[model samples]
Target chain A: MTGQVRTVDGRVAGRRGQATRQKLLECLSEMLSSSPYRDVKVIDVARMAGTSPATFYQYFPDVEGAVLELAEEMAKEGATLTDLVAGRTWTGKPAWAAAEDLVDGFLSFWRKNDAILRVVDLGAAEGDKRFYKIRMKILNAVTNSLTDSIKELQSKGRVDKTVSPAAIAGSLVAMLAAVAAHQKGFQSWGVKQAELKPNLALLVHLGVTGKKPTK
Target chain B: MTGQVRTVDGRVAGRRGQATRQKLLECLSEMLSSSPYRDVKVIDVARMAGTSPATFYQYFPDVEGAVLELAEEMAKEGATLTDLVAGRTWTGKPAWAAAEDLVDGFLSFWRKNDAILRVVDLGAAEGDKRFYKIRMKILNAVTNSLTDSIKELQSKGRVDKTVSPAAIAGSLVAMLAAVAAHQKGFQSWGVKQAELKPNLALLVHLGVTGKKPTK
Candidate 1:
């Protein structure tokens, strides 16, 4: 159940307070997209929201705290990514489709929250535990499921015993996240966006099933 | 050919000038590792370098410009990555060795310059042309060579024609870069550094040859 929204000082936010809080978040998200994370100030976010710095402080402690909030919200949406892998049978033609659909869903999710994800990435890469935890919350949704799938295959002797499911799954997930984050970078290599998805799917299938897709 | 280093004002940097420029760059690089990229200031670098901000200006325009310098230097070092792929055999045990060597070399390269590469990664993601170009310079070195290798295999009917070589190669390289960038993130998932490498090499070999390595 959703808990009551509370301000930094612990008072529950009313409808007006919640509205302003949401407004500040939206403005902060926009600022992150337009400028570097370090340059994003709480005062600037409040100014963008047409409110006072005092009002910004009422909801969030600072820019990093607000960013953590945004990242947490994105992680909730990232939970839906489990559907991309959960119960998907990685067998024959279905395996190819599973990989394709997973790639499609994951990329779209990343593209939607790329700005906040970028900051989260930077934060995690910089060794910030809070940001790192939020990133793990997101990627683990798909990774854990995929890891389970691989382990299932391994148990059936369908996959190699030497393969570590978690490493492969984590690497594959990292690949998707990296490719999604820099989708434009592929264009310069002459790999068109349309072509990237299936190739990625193929690799995902190979990484998971250790075989070329039947399709 | 290595050209003479010059100050921003067009004077050829002598031994002393070059040393000062190098010192400033070293100091800036240290600052980037210790602090956020956006917070690294010319004044701090100058102070750390035991010079004035005016002297810092004499060598580079600003923090981003100096960062570009550092990235360019790292890109030159990245050129050596070509040895991991260029003119190398990609079949049997050699293929496995190729993949392992690449993973070893690429990871070391990223770890060595990770602080600067993080800025380049952020800049590329944010659509900054200069930063994007530098990032491409570093990745294209290996990606292009790997692409040619895949194309060679495809032409010989040793690989799938349906597979986009550039897409597959770029994705693999992106996987390497991403994995290298978040090497620490993998540890949290219970994948240690030693186990991580061989699994990555396995995926690279799979993506490249469309078969698991003989080794």
Candidate 2:
């Protein structure tokens, strides 16, 4: 748990204050979805939340601070992505199913928090440590789980020893994240969403299991 | 060829005009690397370029327009990426080498134009059709070639028939691009650049051939 919510001035927020803060975040989230991150002014977010700019400032220092808070919340939710890979069997039809589920879950999670994730991705890519840490938190959930899967397979001689489990897992997770973020762009290339999932799943299975899936 | 360079007013740029425009773009590109894209203003770019804001406007309608121009230029250069995949064999030891070369080439390209590419990626993800088209133009060069390679393999019955070549190629290329853009981030995950390349190449080979590389 994140412990007691505190204001920028270091005061613990009461129930009413937390409610107001949550409303501001929801309004800011909506604004991010509708407009560019750079153009989302604090005053506009405050107005959208039916509150004064002064009240907004009490909860957060600025728009980036609020966005970071949103990212933190999403990162907490993203931790559950580990379920898509943890303890999953990488053999036979189940391997294929595991890959399919991962691709599906990842794409849906990305589609859900796309706006905030976009900012997190940009911030991380730009070398901001806070954003970078949050990005890693979300990705490591799945990447770490997948890495263990590959390592276990390698130990059993089911996968190649020459393959670096960490690298493959990291790359595969990155692929899923990238593909999810650009799901719409795939449509423009004449690849429908329905067609993309299975292919992505196929690649995931191929990378992890080092063999064609049994379907 | 892309035809005669023209200003926003539709006048053909002479040699001198072209040089000034190029300088402004170079300056803007530098600003993007050093500052957040949202905070980058035309006045700052103009000041850095040793010109007035009026001169910046003559060549570009605004900062985003100038970024699009830079992205367009990068996309043109990116066409050469087709060489990394085009006509590359997917059999034996040569297949492993091809994968390495493609990964190397893609990563180097992303590093060279990271700043502009970052903006382009964000724009495309935000549903800006112009940025999406430019992103497609760059990725398509490699994606199209890789797709053809997969299709050829599939036709020979070497690759699985159920696999969608475009989707696989797109996913693989997306993996490469995503990993490339976040090469620095990988280090934090304990994946060094030297160690990262071979593993990425391994995944690329597996995805394309559906078998581990003979190497």
Candidate 3:
């Protein structure tokens, strides 16, 4: 569990302080959704939160620091993505359903946190270690579980012996993330959301089971 | 074919002007690699190219405009990616080779143009039409070819009838791109580049053919 939430100046934040910090984060998140990440300023975020810039600085060093906090929170929520794959059977109709549920959950998660995730993605791609670690945290949850599923299938001779479980799982997870991030692009390309989900689920089933789903 | 080179002001660029413009672009590309995209300034690019900011403006309206030019050039090169999937068989052992070649070619191309491609990816994710079009142009080269290949297989009864060719092809291409962009992330996660390619190719083959590769 996270320790006491502390201000940038190292003061332990109480209930009211935490509420204020959360409000600032919520306002910052809104700003990220409406404006380019480069153009988001601390002053604007403070104004939007009905607080002073000094209050913003007390809670965080700068805009990037606040964004990192938001990313960290999202990554924690992303950890629960493991439930979408872990303990799920990858056989017959159930396998197909599992794939569908996983795709649905992953896509929705990305869509909900897209603005912050986009910034995290850019920072990670730009070789920032802090952002990279957070990205890994979010992705590794689903990826590790999927890797286990693939390895289990391979052990039963249902999947190929030569397949690298981690690689396949990682690639599939990345695919899900990429497609989720560009859902609008897919729509513009004429693939509707309803059609996209099934196709994605089918591919996930195919990738994991190495066969077409029994559905 | 592209029309004659011209400046932001609409004047045709002479040989010397073209050289200067190319140099400025090259410097801008270098700046993008070494610094955050948000921090890349026209002044810095001009200084690095040994030109004035006014000169930079004469050629490019702003950093983003110059980046679009870089992305445009990269997209042109990316069109050649079609050759990786076009006319390639999707059956038996050759199918495995086809998949491997596609993975190798795609990964290398992404690595070569990662700095600018990262910016394009971010831009497209943020709903920018120009960047989205460039991204579509690059991915569509392979996705469309792969779609045709899958449809051919479906017609021959090799691939599943229920599969959506465009959806599968687009997802697979997106997987390749996401994997390529985060190659370092995979490395840090303990997946070797040598091991990663074969696994990616396997998924590509499986998604396209609905069966594990013969290899």
- Docking quality band of candidate 1, CAPRI definitions: medium
Evaluate all candidate structures by whole-model CA lDDT and list the values in order. 0.93, 0.93, 0.92
Off by over 4 Å in 2: none
Tens digits of per-residue lDDT for model 3, A38-81:
78889999999999999999899999899999999999888889
Chain A TM-score, prediction 3 = 0.97
DockQ of each: 0.78, 0.80, 0.79
lDDT of 1 by residue, B1-215 (tens): 78877889898989888899999999999999998676788899999999999999998988889999999999888889988888888888999999999999999999999999999999899888999999999999899999999999999999999999999999999999999999999997799999999999999999999999998
> What is the C-alpha local distance difference test score of candidate 2?
0.93
For every model in order, the fraction of real contacts preserved is 0.81, 0.77, 0.77
Q: What are the TM-scores, per candidate, against the unseen true structure?
A: 0.96, 0.96, 0.96
Q: What residue pairs are clashing in model 2?
A: none
Residue by residue across A52-155, what tens digits does model 1's lDDT show? 99998888988888999999998998889989999999989999999999999988998899899988999889888998999999999899999999999999
The reply for model 1, stretches above 4 Å from the true place, is: A1-3, B1-4
Tens digits of per-residue lDDT for model 2 on A60-144?
Answer: 9989999999999999988899899888999999999999999999999999999999899898888889999999999998998
